[model samples]
Target: MSGETIYKGNKKILGLTTLSFFLTFVVWFNMAPFTSTIKEALNLSKEEIGVLMSINIALTIPARIIIGMLVDRFGPRKVYSSLLIVMSIPCFIFAFGTSFMQLFIARAFLGIIGAGFVIGIRMVSEWFPAKQVGLAEGIYGGWGNFGSAAAAFTLPTIALFIGGENGWRYAIALSGLLCLIYGFVYYRSVQDTPSGKVYERPKRNGAMEVTSYKSMAGLIFMTLPLYGILGLLTWKLSNTSLINSSLANTIYVILAVIYLYNVYKIWNVNKEHLKEGVDKKEQYSFRQVAILDFAYLITFGSELAVVSMLPMFFEETFELNIAQAGMVAASFAFMNLVARPGGGWLSDKFGRKKTLMILLLCLSVAYMGMSQINSSWPLVLAIILTMTCSFFVQAGEGSVFAMVPLVKKRLTGQVAGMVGAYGNVGGVLFLTVLSFVNPSLFFMTIGVAALLCFIASLFLKEPDTAEHSSIVVQDKAGKEAAM
Candidate 1:
């Protein structure tokens, strides 16, 4: 039998994948550094500023589910390019916003771009086969995630260099231009799959599928956090009090109803198939994917939450200049270019479960070390402690995706979307935790979450080779060479 002509797994795919993220990420975090300028220009309060920032991520959870389905149907190239064009208008509105409401709507529209990350995972999976997915995903995620840091480093510098009250608007508008130009360029250069192969779509959509009624039931339960996190953000608004709680109550009711419907839809779609039993499902377990999804919820989630707060915590606690503090906080993200790829390569080589277990343990230590920080402690030590935490943080990111591409072959996009969304959910919950808690405790709480997930990992079985066999595919080029 001839091996299939799967993705070329070549440099061209890598270049396109990186470029896709670079464009998407700039637009995603374009609001961060410029928030002060936006607030001052519009005469907004800190509370309003906080809401503006939160709104940017608000739409992404649902957007991922929607875009994931779309990507599986239409393919990544169309979905990503189209997302960039539509999202540019929001970037322009955000750049030139005259009021908090304008900024709020722009930020909400910006959530559309966050779904850009999902498109790449499916695209990258198409290019790189199973053996290399870990490293490819690591490179993709580590580089892609660093876009936030890019906004931090470049936007402020651009704002400063432009040397005027309106410098931020220019900086923000620059992102729109990048998105506009790159959208066209990306379309011209990339294909859904290399040469002749057709990109496969999933058998179902709406909710991720599980083989058993129990796991299907669990999948329904898992979706609650996505909505709960949104409600948690709603409460964080200053006017959102418990007594006038009709909106929150209504949202909760809607979420619960949606979840029940989702469970029914998942079961209805898969019930006949499950009764027939998995044709190839004698092997594999959805339980493993569920655990990893939660594991990532804590690991990558903590990373997002920590990175979100670290700059502010460091600035106030250490009494450092804003410049110095931001620089220090940035070390956490900069670790990604190395730490994440290292995690993927390590998992690919050593063992997936062992690497993740070891990293989670180290992550627990890093968080523990961070919780010990005080004004009396040396700054170098504190910095080292944060970077130590970052290594495991990014490594956990690598480990998570390492398993993502290895899950049920056909459902890889759906699985990646759920796991990816959990990372965002982690950010929301951790930052919400930070609202009432102190910084050290904030870091420690994440540690506690990681430890719980780590304990859960103790039950996770390393993915077996046969797991990929259900959707059988082979590399045609390899087969041709062999013949």
Candidate 2:
């Protein structure tokens, strides 16, 4: 195919996949905007409401890991479309749910929809050449991520226009309906890759293949935080009295056993390969993935944490009305549409490592500025700083993913999965910190973490090839050989 034809075809696939991602996000976070409405309708206690919020993210961490594996083994077309169609059931369930138990179950299941983000990383990487992959991934991510904001802004009005006690229910269900319709539309409209390009699956599927025992050990070390964050979530629920002490302890034990089993799976998958030794061409550093994990832990992780609280911060610090504060807070997320893509473009035009380092360093400084915001400071100035801080935070996220696909072609889904899971881990950890400290201290904590990530970024290696268009073909015996 000519370059021009490939470019034109890519635009269509990118748009379709990004739209799938956007609609999933819309359904994933649909409950958030209706928090108060649901509470009032259900006559729920504050603690129950808190539990609802907590469980909504509980499944997402593991879902991303599982979805990543599935995307690699099957293909994004099947996995993503199935994800959208299946998740819509939970969305509909939550929409009509009247009791805390019902809503809680629905929302918890809906968390799996968040895994849709990882599928797109693989899909976009497959379609766009390396030179343009960063910007393309950014557009997919940055635009799709806007769905949450879109839900927040549009859903309430949708409810009001429908105008009834069940208006919120109808509004939320509409998001579910979008998912249902789009699931079929997306499956029909897109392919796993362009017409001539073969979709590659990982050689092994249970766990990521590690080139060295050291890398295996590193994988085990990193897996700890994922389960540890789940433990933290359990602890939080225990404190809220959502789960009793005995139940929480039981959950803790179960989590530990599961973690150990996961470690065994990782070892089991990689042991043979490590014993024989991988060919030099196939060997890539686990350290690279580890670095990206922490980098995301700082960038997207902080964005999740700050977005949750910035409205309350503005409302209290400036004494603005709720509506006024929300509009101001929206500015932070508003940067995603531009800054994330700009970050990727920079990574493409400049260097990935250099762009990420600059963004993280500036992110640290921006948070330091945020940490100092007070009632004495003018609100306009504070909002300006907030937007600036958001630009770096989001752009850094774009930069991180821009390099994700380049790490290894076959492992893109699994790699994106682990890194994306860390972002949530960061969110949970940072929010836990917020629960213990003042807002200023929370900002300072993230600022300090960003500084550490900046130091880590210094070690990121650049991808050798600027474009990954080399073809991989399979012979009759079913072995892949790159051409």
C-alpha local distance difference test of each model: 0.79, 0.91
| Highest lDDT model number | 2
TM-scores, one per candidate: 0.91, 0.97
Candidate 1, residues 1-483, lDDT tens digits: the string is 222444444468777777778778888998888777777788988778877788888888878777877887788888888888778898998888887778888899898788788788888877775666778888988898888888877988987888788998999899898898888888888897766454667676655657776777777777778777777777676364322477767776787787677667777777876787776644357777778888788878898888777888888878998878878778888999999888888888888888888888889888978988988988888898888888999988898888877766556677777787888888888888898889888878888878888888888888764444222333565332211
Alpha-carbon deviation at 424 in model 2, angstroms: 0.5
Q: In TM-score terms, which candidate is top? A: 2
RMSD of 2: 1.7
Clashes of each: 5, 0
| lDDT by residue (tens digit), candidate 2, 1-483 | 454445458889999999999998889888888899888989999999999888888899998999999999999999999999999999999999878999999999999999999999999998888888889999999999999999998999999999989999999999999999999999999999765568878998798878999999999999999999999999999987679999999999999999999999999999888899899989999999999999999999899989999899999999999999999878888899999999999998898899999999999999998999999998889988999999999999999999999999899999999999999999999999999999999999999999998998888888865336665555577776555
* Candidate 1 lowest-lDDT run of ten: 474-483
6, model 1: CA deviation in Å?
A: 4.8
Where in model 1 is the C-alpha error above 4 Å? 1-9, 159-164, 196-198, 238-244, 281-283, 465-483
